[model samples]
Target: MTSDAPHSLPDTLFDTAVVAGVGLIGGSLALGLRQRGLVRRLIGYDASYDVLREAEALGVVDEIKTKPGEWLREAELVVLAAPVRVLPALARELAPFLNPAALVTDVGSVKSGIAAELEALGVRNFVPGHPMAGSERGGVTHARAALLENAVWVLTPTDHTPLTALSRVRTLVEELGAAPVVMPPDAHDSLVATVSHLPYLASLALTHLVARDERLSLLAAGGFRDLTRVASGDPRMSRDMVVANRAALREALLRFRRQLERLEADLEDPEELLAAAQEGKRTRDSLPVVKRSLLPQKHDLVVAMPDRPNQIGRVTQALGAAGVNIKDIEVLAIREEGGALRLGLESVEAVARAAELLTQEGFEVRSRR
Candidate 1:
C-alpha cells in the first residue's frame, strides 16, 4: 500500500536505543530496529545473561549493558520490554536515569498499573505501549524481524503523558513498520482483558479439561489443537499477565458468565443456537487482520490441508520461507480426506505470492481475495 516499504529498513531515528529485555517482544524490536538501521547504537539489558548473549550473537543489538540506568542515561529511545509486574518497579528504578527529553516507552500489556507507577514517580516521558503481537514461543531465540510490521502497536498515553512524547513514540513505531494507535490506559486494559487475556485463560482451562481425560487424546483433531495452542505459552508469564490485569479480567469474566448463561439457555432452542453460531462467524470473519512485513492485508488464501501429521507445518514453512506471513488461520469442515485451511496474509501482493507459491508446491490453493 505504501510503495512496498523499502526492502531496506527505515533510516536511523535515534542516536542510542536501549531495550530492557531481550525476550520475544523485546528481542523482536531490537532485531527490527537493527534490520532497518533505525537506531545508531542499540543497547540491551536483560536479566538473563544467556538471552543477552543470544541476542548479541543474533546481531539484534549493538551491545549489551550491565544495567538499565547506564544505557538509560545516554539513550534517545528507551524501551522497557519487561513483564507487567516488573514494569512498575522498572519505572521507579529508571526514573533517575532518564532526562526530560528522552522518549521512554514500554512493551507491557497491562498499562494502567504501569501508568500509575509512572504518574507516582513523575515520569512524564514514559509512554506505555503494548504491541498486540507475539508467537506461542517465547525468548530471544525465536525473535523475528517481521513480527512488528503492520501490527497494531497500542500506546496508552494518559493526561500526564506529554504530547511530544506520544508523537515521538508514534514516529518510532512507524519506523519499525508498525501501526501506532493511541488509547487511554484503562480503556486498553479493559478491552484487551476480554479479547487477549480472557482467551488465554479459556485456552488454559480447555487444555486442562482435555488433559484430564486421557481417552480424548485419541480422537483429538485440528479444532481441539487450535483451541488449546495458546495454553502452551510460558506458564509463569501467562499467569502473570492474567493476574496483573485482574480487575478488568474479573469484569470481563463476569460479562462472559452472562454470555455463557445465555448460551446455556439457548441450548434447548436449536434456532437460537444456530443464530448465535452464525452471528459469531460473522463477527469473527469481520475482525481486522494485522498485516505483517512483506505480506498482504488479511486475505483468506484457502487450501485443502490433508488430515495428517505435519501438514499445516509444511504450508507454514513454505510460506514463511517465501516471506509470506500468516496473520491468522482456520481449519473448517475437517474430514479424513482433508480440511479447508483459510490462511490470512497481509497484502494483495502477499496473497498473490502465497497462492502462487502454494500452487507451485502442489497444494490446491484458491482465494476469494
Candidate 2:
C-alpha cells in the first residue's frame, strides 16, 4: 500500500454507487470512493435521517436517501455497511430496487449467517466481506478515508458466486488501497472469532474485572490502557458482533480457558512458567512484520519526548520539512510528564533520516526493525 492514499484507481469505475448505513465504515468507504473518483455518483442510505443529512453535508456522498427507491436502479455497485445482524434484512429490503447489473457487498463482521441469508433471499450477486480495520470510536463523525488503507479486506465468495462478480469486488478492494484475501464464509467467521471477536470480549472482561476495585482502577497505567483499549468501543456494536458469532466465540473462550488452566496447573513450576512466558514472547516477536500484507515492510522508529504541548506536532513538522512521511503512528506510552511515540516510516532511509532529525532536536529516538 502507498504511504498516503491509493496508488491508482481501478481501470473500470462504477457509474453510480450506493452505501447503506453511512456509519463509520460506510461513510469512510463513501468518502474514499468519491475522493478517488472511483464512482461517478455516490448515494448514501441510512435508517436515521439525521445521519444521511450529515453525510450529505460533509460531502461523503453526492446525495442521501432514507429508503430504497428508483435511485438504487442506477447504482452499479451497492455496499451494505450495516451491523452484522441486520445486514440480511437490509439487503432484502433493498433487493427489489437493485438493478440486475448491480453487485452487492457488505462490511459486516459476521459472514456465514448473512451470506446464507442473502443467498436464501435470492441476492445472487452478493459477496460477503469484512475489512480487518476499525476504531473504537463510532459514527460518521469519526470516519476517515484512510481507515482502510493497508487493511486486509477479506472477501468470502461461495461456490455459487459468479467469477465476474468476485473479480470486480477484488478489484474494488485493491483500488481502495487494501489487500484482498479470499476465503470461505465459515472459515472467515471462525478465524475472526479468535483474532477479532475474542479480543474484544477479553478487553471487556478485563476492564470489568479491574473496575471492581476503585484503587486498582486508579492505579492502572499504560499497559492496562493498551490491553483494554477495545473495551471503550461502542457497546451496542460490540454486543451485536459477539452475539452474531456466539457459537465460534464460545468455542474460542473454551480454548482460552483450557490454556489458562494449563498455566495454572504449572504455577508451582517456575521453569515451566518461564518457558511459557518466553514462548509467548518469541511467538509475538516472530509474527510477520507488515501492515497485513507480506510485502512492503515498514520501518518503525520510537521517539521519547517530554509531555509538553506541541511535542508531537514539532516532531511531525520536522519530518515533514525533511520530506519523510509517516505512514502510521501510535502513542506507545503515556505519562503525566512524558510519553513515547512509535512512528511507521516507509523505508529504512526514511527511518534513519527521521532518527537523525529527531535526535538533533533533542528527542530520544530508537529504530525498531
Over the stretch 81-108, how does candidate 2's per-residue lDDT look in tens digits? 9988788789889988888778999999
- Model 1, position 360: C-alpha lDDT score: 88
Superposition TM-score, candidate 1 onto the true structure: 0.75
TM-score of each: 0.75, 0.75
Write candidate 1's Cα lDDT for 75-177 as tens digits: 8888999887788776777788887677889999898988888888887788899998988888888898798888888999888876556756776787888
Top candidate (lDDT)? 2
**C-alpha lDDT score of every prediction, in listed order:** 0.81, 0.84
| Pairs clashing within candidate 1 | 295-347, 296-346, 296-347, 297-346, 297-347
Candidate 1: stretches off by over 4 Å:
1-10, 69-71, 292-369
